[model samples]
Target: MAIDKEKIKQAIRLFLEGIGEDPDREGLKETPDRIARMWEEFDRQREFNFKLFEEFGDYNEMVIVKDIRFYSLCEHHLLPFFGKVHIAYIPDKVVCGLSKLVRTVKAFSLRPQVQERLTQQIADFLQEQLNPKGVAVVIEAEHLCMSMRGVMTPGHITVTSALRGIFLKDLRTREEFLKLIGKQGL
Candidate 1:
């Protein structure tokens, strides 16, 4: 669904007033418009436009794209959670361009999200799109909601992973994926 920019602007103005800040103040007058525009940017969907290719010389090994940086707003508190995502998939008979993995992470992460769900969504999308033998996605993020409030522990990162198919059933495969992503194997 399309986002309503006007409604967002109005809501931001109301939020500013509710927080006891004057919406018309010199510094704050444009804050509402800026916030609305930020959401609009997130609302625009960028096409993946990636095509899968047939097997290349009988090559069928794990393809990995790691350290893909992403920034997303938390669904719980609307706070920022910025992170890196690592994706790996064992193609069955087809493989797409490596950059497609990075694009997949970006496509799923630009929306309001939780790290756990974001991890799974990437894995699931890859599994469906590539029909891979397995898919693994790992995310490490620092949440402003946790760092700026509550326990207020800054610099603490939350790690989440999703494993599917062969990655779940094969210990060696899972271990290899974790090791390559700079995490110790279980």
Candidate 2:
């Protein structure tokens, strides 16, 4: 769905007013509109373009996409959590295009999310979409909520992972996946 720019701008104006800023001031007049556009882009995760998943043929292998950068909001403090996501799936009959994996990560990581749930969601989606033999997802992130406010572990990275099917049942398969992602023996 397309974004309602005017409505988002009005919400931003209300936010500015609540924060004791004059939205009508010269410098602040365009702030609402700009913020609205930013939010529209940030919420792109709500929409999914399934057409991007249609390009894979019969190739069956462990498809791994690593170091995909993303930025998301923490649901608790509404602060930013920036991170890299690594995904690997052992395909069955259908395989997804390599770039589609990145798109999948972006599609979910663009909104309010928790690293743990986000990791699982990506793994689940790959399982559902491709019916893969197994799926693995890992995320490493630094949250502004934790670094700038709570606990304040500045520069400390939080990691989360989700493993399904063979990735969960077979230790060797899981270890191989971890090694491929360069997180083995950690």
Candidate 3:
């Protein structure tokens, strides 16, 4: 469904009032419009089409894209969580562009999300589209809800991973993927 910018603007105004801020103040008057526009830009995931880039390829080895930076809002608290994602897949007969892997990560991260679900969605999308022999995704993030609020452990990072097909069934394949991504203690 499409997001209603006007509704967002109205909501922001209401939020400011609820927080005891005057929405009509000179400095705050344009805040609602700015927030609405920001949401529109961040929500570009809705427009991304992953299937448009699938193509035949002779390569059959593991394709790994690591250290993809992503920023997302925590669904529970609406706080920011920023981190890196590492994705790997062993193709069967086709592959996608390297940039598409980054785009996939961006598409998923553009919304309010949990790192675990975001990891799984990326793996699932590659598994379904490329029908790869295996797919793996690892994400490490520092959530502001956790660090800036709750526990307040500023440097703490949460790591999550999703493995499918061979990566789930084969220990060695999973190990290799982890190793290639410079991850240890799997």
Top candidate (lDDT): 3
Ranking by lDDT: 3, 1, 2
Q: For candidate 1, give the lDDT of residue 6.
A: 88
Query: How do the residues 45-160 of candidate 3 rate in per-residue lDDT, one tens digit apiece?
Result: 54565653345566788999999999999999999999999999998878887888898888888889999899899889878877889999999999999898988889889999
The sequence of per-residue lDDT tens digits that candidate 2 reaches over residues 67-157 is 9998888988879999899899887767777777888888888777888889988888888887889999989999999898979778989
Q: Give each model a TM-score.
A: 0.93, 0.87, 0.94
Model 1, 92-150: lDDT tens digits are 88999988887887788888899999999988888999888999988999999999988
In angstroms, give how far residue 97 of model 2 lies from its true place: 0.6
Q: How many pairs of residues collide in model 1?
A: 0
- C-alpha lDDT of residue 169 in model 1: 96
Model 2 spans with C-alpha error above 4 angstroms? 43-48, 51-58
Which 10 residues in a row give candidate 1 its minimum summed lDDT?
39-48
lDDT of 2: 0.84
